[model samples]
Target chain A: MIVDTPLLIITDLVKEFNDGEISTTVLNGLSLSLDRGEFVALLGPSGSGKSTLLSILGTLMRPTSGRFEMLGFNLIGARDVDLTEFRNQHIGFVFQAHNLLPDFTALENVMFPAATRKGRETPVDRRRATELLDKVGLADRRDFPASKLSGGQKQRVAVARALMNSPDLVLADEPTGNLDRESARRVMDLLIDLNGTDGTTFLISTHDETIAGQCRREIRLLDGRLARERH
Target chain B: MTYSFKVALRYLASNRAQTALLIAGVAVGVYIFVFMSALIGGLAVLLLNRTVGNIAHVTIQAPDRDPVSLYGRDSGTLVAILKSVQQRTTLQSAAAFLPAIEAIPNVTSVAGVVAGNGFLTKGEAIAPVIVTGVEPDQVSAIANVAGNLVAGSGDLTIGIALIGSGLAKTMGLQVGQRVSIRSERNIDATLLIGGVFSLGVSSVDDGAIYVHLRTARVLFELPDGVSRLEVKLDDLRLAPEVARRIANTTGLKSIPWTEKNEQLLNGLVAQARSGDVIKGFALVTIVIGVASALLLSTYRRQSEIGIMRAMGATRRFVVGVFMIQGGLIGLAGGLLGAGLGYLSLLPFPLPEATSSTGLPIAIGEGAYGTAILLTFIGAIFAAIWPASAASRVDPVKVIGP
Candidate 1:
């Protein structure tokens, strides 16, 4: 499933934040591309625009000036509604804080994308969600509320949710940033296993060098631009 | 169910205490609305019943004749004048109009009456009185005279009559006693008092007497037609329309009870307006309470909303979740409040003979349907601000840096 064709392309992307008299440029002329089914890690220090890049790629933020094409369609100037649908169909996200709806069960959290997209939960969605939960080693905890889960378990559920829609690309921002060493290892293993079996591409932003070493490619950002790349 | 609705339910179920408190607040507001509606509605009914119970809903009488001057055609001078102050105006051919008057919709009963001024004389005392004559069987058709009788029976025979308690007291007259009645037309007769009644109206209780129509014609010297017609209606509110129809059909002067009781109608209207203001305030309070609480909830769940947005949930979806929550609260609160209002008023009995001054709350008039519909709609309106705010949450800012 590792195709030679590129899945996404970025050129001369720029992003700036303004507060009255102050203008802070988060991404300045940064550009990168990813091929289908590639596992890439984004490495950067604090305030190095790693998260900003992930946000733009996930279609959650608009770049001030850039050319962004994902799945052969231009995304830089797309309408918000169109972008929302494109993201739901083509992109997935796992936040650093494991932002699952605390009131819902693990299985419900995993089924959130499909249920919201279809307007209601169907039998197929339930089956897929149950399978995802079992794959994440939380089959017994499928009915447990998100608030009742431990931090690491919550992160694992977040990963399962990001994969529930079967999106082509998953943008994970420090997915295991708040977990202990053992929990972090287990989550990373799960991500790798899913990528190898399903052929889903992953672009993970992380400060942990050990996590970056496990990816097929590593990208480093410095002062809002690509500083280095290694394979 | 739709995911939006499911999510709204989950959110509410997660915060049980807050949800219950919000619903309770809405219920209290709805209860106030229902209470006001029932009280004001009940008071109006009570007033109308008391006022219209003892009088005709519509009265048809002969048109008044004003004096006119005879002018000479050749000169601008008044030649002669015609004026009569003592002439009695009687409805001519009253019997011919009874069928037409009774045919009007909502007309329950119609009675032809002969009324005239007279004097009641006992052996040692004399009192001025008004003598009303009607058919023996229809004595209570317009006024409930039979129901108010305190002694003897409401019998109107050729030589027997009914007198008010005030007139009976002043002359020391009792049932089975004879009294002399002298009419303004100079006709006189001695009749035995068959009954005594107290109608609660001071003027009527002091001087009114009832006699047979045959005897009244002879005493008042009305040999041709009855004096006037008294009309009763099933619904007193239809009096004006019924009176209009009667006047058109009978060629007589018709008067409705509402025109005669202007002050009472005005008081009832003012009371209703005040109740509306109170009900309006209650709804406003409910709207404010729901809006503020939902706004807080939106703020508290910012990160969750951000996650949903990042997961490709549309702004409309987010809005639907919040609005559904508001609608649910409104519907539940409305039902609870209406039930509570009804149950609370059940202990207070309606006004009756045993308790004439009972609590004036009409439980059946609580306006439950209106309360529920308004509250449900109001709650949805209240959630607009919060729903919009939640939909506008920035996914990047909350979920990322």
Candidate 2:
């Protein structure tokens, strides 16, 4: 039964990978939905298709078959250009490696998503980027090049960049995967804090129980299929 | 700057060695282009000037045929006999045509001469010669014969004549030596050799002599006829038009220098066409080099391109970024090439040369501007395919990998 009008809907999503003559199912009839401000974790072991589902959700890859909708807009059959625009305006991604564009400064990295949308940096953008850096406790390190920052700082900048465009959803694909224990804790704390304050939906794919435990909900995948959900 | 432009700058700045190499390649190409055009163009102009400097731009002479009477055949027969007996190749009273010709716009100078074949004798030896009657100042103004004079004054007096150095040497004569010259009509005169000159042409130097117009008329027994009139114009290129105008106005046949030097002009045109081919090849090499360099650059920046695409840069924006990079590189190279080419020409000044140094070249502003524009376009065109390839980078595959 439909309890409420959800911000996202996915009905029997399917994804498969082909290597020459043979094909393997990465996601099999998987279905999930999210509200406007939900902090959800996708938990799975290796080869469980958690990353594949996240890739499809982020519009980086096409699904084999399914109906996926976000804010009442059909996403499954959208054209490539429309998908790219949808991602730019509505979805932000934080990769495990931070993916901070090594050539840019921390502040520039934080402002990049917004600049990519606007095609230029304005004074208001600079102020917003500075405020985001300040919120992430990396104000003093804003001018530093991303390459020069510590692993923790880069992840923090990636988080700030993800929020720069004020996207409706932030997809974190094992964002703390490469970090040390302390850096991982800090990154998890940052994501939780942003989720709590900003009221933005989050879909974090992680195998780490400690990170998943911190989320409001955890959905586990088994053998390319959704096995259980816990809240 | 736009996002793409900033990204382009960042990419180029990060790849210093590649950028430097590309600029250097373009600079060298531009240098070659500028140097070749200047060298060949300068040599062409020099050859043209040397060939036509002392020659007439246009020459006016009497019509080769005599007019026939329309009324009677006997009248035509009498006119033909008179013309044959009178040696009608000469223009009767050609001096009257000078003022009319000189009045034409663009005509710098006009000079008439009476010329005929004769012989010079000393003691027992005799040499055949071509004698010319000229007003020294007027002929010098039109033909610039005074500039090539090897010795003595150009003044032609009644009893004095100027003989070519070869003729003077053959007759065992020097300045102030007396020589007997006889015309084809059996008229003879004994004149003193007042000057010796060398016109560089062996035919003229070996057998030509100059005398006063009155003396030549008396020697030829013509009283008042000239062989031909030579005209100089402000611009030699205007010779055909001036010749046409003179022919229309004076009822005289005018021959321009281009008609007289048809073979040489044809050779020069062929040389220029070959020069253009070489320039075209050089430009192609430069364009290919730039294209190859940009293609390598595109592959090297594939990851960055993927991230940019993932960040929501459109395919057109991605292509624009690489195009900007290519344009900037080409612009930098073209400007640098122009500077390099200009500097290379500074060491040698014009009008000084040897076999080793060859001739000094002149580079014009038009050549520099043209080279810059051509390379800019070539560089942009060279970048299109690579930029398109860069735009086609798959974000999911590239980013994940």
Candidate 3:
């Protein structure tokens, strides 16, 4: 109940959705806690608000009423500029679709978050990005466009991009949903491997139970509520 | 914004069809703007230069009859106004011409003079001619009027009249022969012809003969007053402004020849306005092109825009990116328009087209300044809506699943 000086802490978070005359509740008193270096898996059905919770965690939306804190910055009250800076300095995200810029090569796509936060490209940023690309085994495909990569390679590049700034927290919403079973396992292993090696905490939402078994901790959501936390 | 710009550039470059359409639109707008400015500027220059060529600014004409009433101008007031205007610091030089203007002011050398309308009879041939009276030594200052007397250069020594090739052919007159001209103003006096001046405009050479103004007036028995005032300005443009001042100052209305030929003035004015209207049409086409190009471009990338917002890009970033795209299109089009217009002018040689061979081609400085301004303004205007649409992309989630 008291502050644990946690890496991420959310209390009584509620996000409501309205479809014209009808209003639907997406999250109801969704409380969660994550400490440093914790790898979390969020398992839910298609309409269970797993992605919504991730969006809130990433500072992409304001909770209807609740408290959210990340790395000592107040999430619910952050300005656009401050939130952007905070995201730049702390949070990283990977998606189910890979979502790489088709025009830029894999290396350049990985650097998008860095450039978005800081509008210039210095030599040091390039060096750091190339290092992350190497970590995700995409060093050879650095100049290849995301479209040219295999599903596994594209998701690998996505992981590289998520770690571009070496942030303390990484969010992966279905990091392997679009991949073959073998590729799904490989990307899951890579994310778990990175959590151990870099000590970067990760929160992942996945439908695959095999992917969920790979994480150190699991939080399952049912109908927009935290139904179970497995240790 | 810089990152957004980079994205915009990539987006524009990747979509070749969209980029081409936008540039084409922007270029058209730029072209119209540049050409309109040049055409307006060109028309003004033509008036200013031509007015100064034959007439002097700030002439003193007798205030007796209002020039508007057609009561005829007073040559007596010509000297008084000249003296008065000459005293003012604003005026450069003042020349007082007699009602019959037997002299050129400031310069003592008077070229061949022209007295309009004469009946010529030489060697059993009779042709109507415009009789010009010119001083023997002052032929060079007449410019085109000097070239008109190409045939009998040496005739002025013994007072033999030079005949135009056209007049010579028509009248059946030859060199060293005397022809008789009955003055139209007098109809009774016979003036001895000295030479012919063949100006290039057909009416100028075929219709005219050269004689001394003194001799022509003597033959016509005209009073010493010049029927019309021909004033020169340092810059012909100053003539209009200075003319307004003179009209206001002396209460004497002086009609510039450019004004006197109302049909020509109106025609030229209409030509220029039509040029602007054509330019407007070109601009409208460009607007349509830019609008559609941007609309298509945004439509094609609606999903990408949604994805970008999901990537945490702000609405402002998306909007800024699109705006920059518009700015770039406008800038590129503007540059192209200016370049195309300038290139087009290269074929029109000012020396050949203008009466003044010495008329400096002034396309250098003003044109460049105009192109830069037009390109920037036009490009931004063309791209504005499309870029705003980009900004209006509410975090692709609204548009995307």
Candidate 4:
């Protein structure tokens, strides 16, 4: 189902940090592109700018210098509000910490992105959230508060939430970083199954080589730039 | 409910203890505001009632005559003529002005009074007194002489007079005892004591006397005129405007009770201003409480806010969630505090003139609407800073890096 169309393109992306008198470059002229429905793994060691690149790609942070376009929209210089609307409709995120609202139930957590975009929760959002929870194999735990859920269950709920809006692409940063081996395997299996069944593109950052091997394509970063790519 | 409000509610519900404490703080502030308002309002009403209860709201007296020039217009020489010192100016044809005075809206009663300085002599114990003479039936028209009578009745017949308890005690006079009242005109008459009153005012209780209008006219040699006219109104607050109208209707000098009690009015205004300052401080406390608590909430929910932002929720949405939390807290606290304030003041008894402990707090005057509105609006204003701070949460920092 993988299309040859370019879902996102990043060119000469540069990011730096300034601390008073010292300057440090995090991303130096990084460039890459992802095809539609591609399950890509971003591999890097610490301080390699994988998170920064993902942040820039997620429209959460602006790179110091770069040309970034996704789905034919120029994202590098867009207004924050307009970028937020674009991101809500077309991009989703799954964080390493599984940052679910601890006060909300699993079902509510899954429905949050769509509900927030629409200003209120509709029955269709509820149905889709329920179906996503079932797809993630936690439909029975949908009513449980996220804080009460185990680490693995929380990560599964995060995955359901990321896919709630049917976004074209999902940027997952260390999605299995905190999970146990079995939990991480199950989460990766769910992501791969969803990619095959729904044709949703995924760009996942991971430190584990085993996790990187599961992706259809693997890209490695060194000194903030793409060092190598294997398809 | 909207997603923002739902998120706010979930946040509050998750930390029940903290939310309850925050609401309690706001409630206590609102309670203080409501209690202070009711107490101050009641004190003002009590003071007004005590001061003007038995006094004329508007008094009509004869206008003073201006001295005339002795020179004729053709002579072109002015000579000042002094006013007559012996003659006491009286309101001539005072009965003719009663109808016009009574016609004023809200005027309750009017009494023609022959007021003059007199002496009460019982044996060799003689005391100077201010005499107020009114018709027998209208004896208590201007003052609550009948209601405050300590002994005998307020019957001011031809041979009967009323005196204050202090005067009676001073002269060793009792009801039905005969006493001689002599006017400044050197006219004297013997009358029996009809009533004794204690109005709780030192001057009136010590040196005031009430007699029949016919008796006073005969004694003061004013058979065709009264000294002044006393007019009472349903509401004492309307004295100034009513006084002006009465003055204009009848060519007489009219004075309102407010003009005579300027110092008391000033004191009341000062008291009210102090109360307002206290109420304003209560509102400030509410604002501070809501702001600080919401700021803490924003900090505690940083990662969650970051996640929502990364999920493509707008900064405005994040701000909306926090602001809604503040508004809900304020509304709940306001309602609870208003109810508690009213219930707290309910057991206290209404003020009475004779009651030793006059706790003048009118529960009905708690200004509930004002307190609630101020708290709600203040809390919303308080949320602004914390909400903005929440909206500035960097998703990249909290979510991963």
Binned by DockQ into CAPRI classes (incorrect, acceptable, medium, high), candidate 2 is: acceptable
Candidate rank order under DockQ: 1, 4, 2, 3
Pairs of residues clashing in candidate 1: none
Q: In model 4, what is the error at residue A202, expressed in angstroms? A: 1.0
Model 4: chain B TM-score relative to the native chain B: 0.86
Estimate the TM-score for candidate 2. 0.82
Per residue, candidate 2 scores C-alpha lDDT tens digits across A117-196 of 77888889999999999998899999998999999999999889888878888999899999999999988888888888
* Tens-digit per-residue lDDT, A1-231, candidate 4: 656669999999999999999999999998889988999999989888898888888888898998999998999889999999888888888888889988889999999889999999999999999999999999999999999999999999999999999999999989999999899999999999999999999999999899899998999999887889999
Write candidate 1's Cα lDDT for B230-347 as tens digits: 9989988888998899888877999999899999879988999999999999999999999999999999999999999988899999999999999999999999998898888778
lDDT of 3 by residue, A70-171 (tens): 887778988865665676568778888887777778888888777766665557878887888888887888889777899899889888888887888898
TM-score of model 1 (first chain only): 0.98
Each model's lDDT comes to 0.90, 0.82, 0.67, 0.90
Q: Write the per-residue lDDT of candidate 2 for residues B1-401, one digit (tens) a residue.
A: 89878988887898799899988999888888777777777666666555675678998998767644444566543333223345557888687887899899999888787778898998998999998888766646654556666777777778888888898788888887899999987899999988888765566778988888888888888787688898888878788899999999999999999898899788878977887787788788778988898899888878777777766767888888888888888888888998888887876555224234576475542278888888898888988989999988887777751
Give a tens-digit lDDT track for model 3, residues B169-243.
677665556777777765534434545555554554566565655665555555354333344444443445655
- Cα lDDT tens digits, model 1, A8-109, are 999999999889999999899998899988999999999999988999899999998989999999998899989999999888888888999899999999
Cα-based RMSD of candidate 2:
5.0
TM-score of chain A of each: 0.98, 0.96, 0.95, 0.98
**How many backbone overlaps does candidate 1 show?**
0
Candidate number with greatest DockQ: 1
* Model 2 clashing residue pairs (backbone): none
Model 3 misplacement above 4 A: A1-3, A77-82, B17-133, B140-143, B149-190, B197-209, B213-263, B310-314, B334-375, B396-401
